[model samples]
Target: MSERVILTTSSHLEGYRVTEHIDVVSSECVFGMNILKDMFAGFRDFFGGRNKSSQAALRDARITCLDELRREAEEIGANAVIGIDLDYSEISGGGKSMLFLVATGTAVKVTKV
Candidate 1:
């Protein structure tokens, strides 16, 4: 397919029919904040406010995960991914903060209805 892969959180796409079930694809990412970012985030945490650096890190992780998912789907000749599920966790310990994200979905070949 020449177009971008359709991604949906729902079980199915509205106007497309699944013609082939290629496989289930997943992408995982691990991210960490730098010392400066951590210091800033820690300061914000002390004040009980939103941490922009942490938020940006997570946003980047999610975007990277989705991009990887799309790449995998395309590699399998899939035009869409449905039933997408996202999992997020903080893997922090020993005075270090880290973020982990995983994205999973069913890769399928679809045709316009």
Candidate 2:
């Protein structure tokens, strides 16, 4: 069985789902990744005027956050994460930099139609 299945927007399948709660599903997820462009965009938001520190901070944040999400999915046996939601926040303290990400989705096993 394929460990990771990437579903296109138009592709119709029976095993993909996006929701808060999933009950009685058998699957396994390996990891999740973002395209390079998206990683760059996240950094741009952190940097006010294309600064290096902000760029580096954002990169680290994204990596750390995604790692946590993937870890959670792996623990629960997810083959592929669908309906990804991104949440970001700016640090409140003066001169502080940080961001947060939470990924939630359903894990299901797909059988041939």
Candidate 3:
């Protein structure tokens, strides 16, 4: 099996040196809430409580986007991705809403320093 790609939010690794810089890699994930979840969220909003469904959806989307980002880095012959960034946004209209997540980073080949 292939090795897993390492991901880091820092520009440089602690004990590794970047030998080659590859192209930037990014991944996006979109998730939509069902009517039940929407209703729960609305109720939570009115009563002032945590929305578990929405939180779970956001967490799942984040994980999916990060996994896709790692795959993209591996495809380009990169063993690691540095300076990773994640962005989240919500799209809503006509009584519908979706969560959009994006993961971006610089793919690079690294060696032990």
Better of 2 and 3 by TM-score: 3
Clashing residue pairs for model 1: none
Against the reference, the lDDT scores of all candidates come to 0.91, 0.45, 0.93
Please give the range of 10 consecutive residues that has the lowest summed lDDT in model 1.
90-99
> Best-fitting candidate, measured by lDDT?
3
Instruction: Return the clash pairs for model 2, or none.
Output: 28-78, 28-79, 29-78
- The deviation in Å at residue 7 for candidate 3 is 0.7
State the TM-score for model 1.
0.91
Model 1, residue 19: what's the lDDT? 92
TM-score of each: 0.91, 0.48, 0.94
Global fold similarity of model 3 (TM-score): 0.94
* Model 1 CA deviation exceeding 4 Å by range: none
lDDT of 3 by residue, 18-113 (tens): 999998999999898888999988899999989988999989998999999999999889999999999999998988888999999999999988
Per-residue error for 21 in candidate 3, Å, reads: 0.8
Order the candidate numbers by TM-score, best to worst: 3, 1, 2
Per-residue error for 3 in candidate 3, Å, reads: 0.8
Return whichever of 1 and 3 wins on TM-score: 3
